[model samples]
Target chain A: MKRGSLYTLAYAAVLGLVCALTLSAVDGFTATRKAANARAEEVRNILTVLGVPVDADAAPQELLRVFEDNVTEEERGTRTFYSYEHSAKGFLRAVRFGGPGLWGRVEGFLCFEEDMRTISAVTFYRQEETPGLGGEISSSAFTDQFEGLSAVGPDGSPGIRVVGDGADDINEVDAISGATMTSDKVEDMLNRTLEEMIGRDGFDG
Target chain B: MARADKQACATCGKGVCDGKGVVTFKDGVWHINPVAVQVLGICSALAVTNRLENSLVMGAALIFVTVGSNLFVSLLRNITPRRIRMIAEVAIIATFVIVFDQVLKAYYWEMSKQLGPYVGLIITNCIVMGRAEAFALSNRPMVSMVDGLANGLGYAAVLAIIGFFRELIGTGGLFGHQLLSEAWYTPNQLAVLAPGAFIALGFLIAIFNAISGANREEGSQR
Candidate 1:
């Protein structure tokens, strides 16, 4: 029985430890900043929904400042301000809107001011839509139209319509040229969210 | 005679390239195809084919990882013990995967986001390991390098074709810009979805299989 020495195991253990430490350090070095960058990216996306110009390259501090000045948060049901520095505000201006998608949950954040009739910014947290088509909803072209779009209907209804071109309503953003289903789904989700915030729901999940 | 060296050994499937420049055109055309022909390295193939830009990034990333992994594994084959070879191969491959991942993040941050987790998933791709053990372990570094390049090209060829269709049809655009006359048909948004990837992949696989079969028949005639 010509058994090899413990050297092989020693070699493997050392090698494994080195790899683990290196990977962990790489992850650690980036994790906090990535998290903060992600948060900033969210803020920037929210600002885009408000139709404000976003420089993703800007410092997160500057981005946060821009977000603070432009889009104040409102509570879910009460339209209470949720801006961080505003100690008296009751809730965050942004609320999460989500529902089932073709692949998984289609969730986005909607940031608004004290008046919930306008959507200051929108950013989807998760979606598995068709990559080029529904996927492009995440694209600037698609999401950009959402800026300046009204959250409430002209009749002062709490919901918005996903309509084709020619809707005279200020709240209506034209449907994506080919992605009608995904477009409708986002519109429907927002409408349901509005309904929930207005106390129309029997219960909030 | 060549027949004498062909004696069946206990490790029959392990009769890898014997470092004698035994690489051939068949390796390129079919035997080691990164996709349907070899049925290897497909997870990333499906995920990153949505946009041409992302697909190209994924392709380049894989090429770098595969070739680097192959070179290192082949170079280290002699010193490695037979028992722990798998671990050795993985360590070598993972090293390259990390470097590839970091380079993408540093240089192509936007494409990296669009690709999502698929960049990391390259580590798990069977073809990279498959080539490492099957060819690289036994072949010289230069030929092993070619094997890696060929396999990557095979995969990229399929991916680019798929990307072209997925981008053009799915978004009514190509490479992130509009190209189609919207009047013909609204973007077949369905094509950009995951199911579209599967459908397109299946057709492309069929087309390749057919061409390969025809080529085989022609060779027999010749």
Candidate 2:
């Protein structure tokens, strides 16, 4: 065999073999941790945006306290909330949140009570916005405003739609001040999520 | 001295035809500058430049990717054929990108998420390929090694300067913390956007070109 031919064959095989091995190893190393981190971040986002008291890097327990209503996912699309059992106690409901974004999309979940009225926990799935300005929608000041508010709209519909408030009232969100589009998008997204999850009729509660 | 010269002659071609370091230097400084010259890897610079702290982390990642790929390509240059060099180059680059990506996740998860797709995009960065083909392929290992270092350092300096301005103006902060006093003027939101990267880079390139051009003229006259 020619020297060049032998070198080329061996090198290609070795490179290919090494790449395959590295790909598997990288997947193994990152996939599990990445998934867990993603879940935790989602939980944190929901908690933060809903005005729930959970740190951005808070553990699952911090979120669990508020999200005590474990609503398991319905197989036949019966219930909107995902329910799960707690420490040998009762169940809890994790309400799903979704909305259009200025650029792409934003989604999240907030677990609440059986009445589907009071806030439980909040998290965002996706948000493509300017980091500090629009992205601050994830801040507690914004979500904390949602806490203790009626889950139904002004029309008494399920899932309240956020409208811009002229005053800096604590109960009403101020519409992200300069970021009107982002604010509106999130508001509409919340309204749409409520409409889809619940119903056109007012909250049965 | 006598034995060294004899060994050089008998070798397949490392010492005989290797580039005398100039090609690698040019690759680092002129042809494939990480910022202005080649315009490669600008996404990370834009995304992370919001803070000097994040930019430093990003720059370090860039350096590691460039150096890791450069070393591997040079080491395997003996076996890499001319026909499929590009294939080998991309594979080597991707391998290093994964390594850096994993490292970032393990330690700096927040910064890693902020950096997002830039780490994965390192595989497509032209600086790595440009240096690998132009210098690493034609040189000894040490020369190629130095080439990667110089490029990385140069790239980092550019990132730091941009980050300095963007962070100060955009957020009145450094590394995501407030640096300016409360009395400072309002932050310039424009500097934080993607378009700001283009504007800042344009001015930087023009200034860089002007300064280098003046130096050349002075040297010639002298």
Clashes of each: 5, 22
**Highest-lDDT candidate:** 1
- Model 1 lDDT, residue B78, Cα: 64
Candidate 1 lDDT over residue span B101-205, tens digit each: 765665555666788788888888897888899888876576687788777777777788889899998988988789988888699867877888899998988
- Shift of residue A200 alpha carbon in model 1, Å: 18
Question: Model 1, DockQ value?
Answer: 0.16
Question: lDDT tens digits, residues B17-37, model 2?
Answer: 344456656656655566766
Docking class for model 2 is acceptable
Q: Show where candidate 1 strays beyond 4 Å.
A: A1-5, A21-39, A49-51, A55-92, A95-107, A115-122, A127-205, B1-26, B29-31, B214-222
DockQ of structure 2: 0.39
- After superposition, which runs of candidate 2 have C-alpha atoms over 4 Å from their true positions? A1-11, A29-32, A49-94, A99-103, A111-114, A118-125, A129-149, A162-189, A196-204, B1-32, B214-222
lDDT of 1 by residue, A148-202 (tens): 5677777877777778774578887767767788888888888888777654442
Instruction: Assess every candidate by TM-score.
Output: 0.66, 0.75
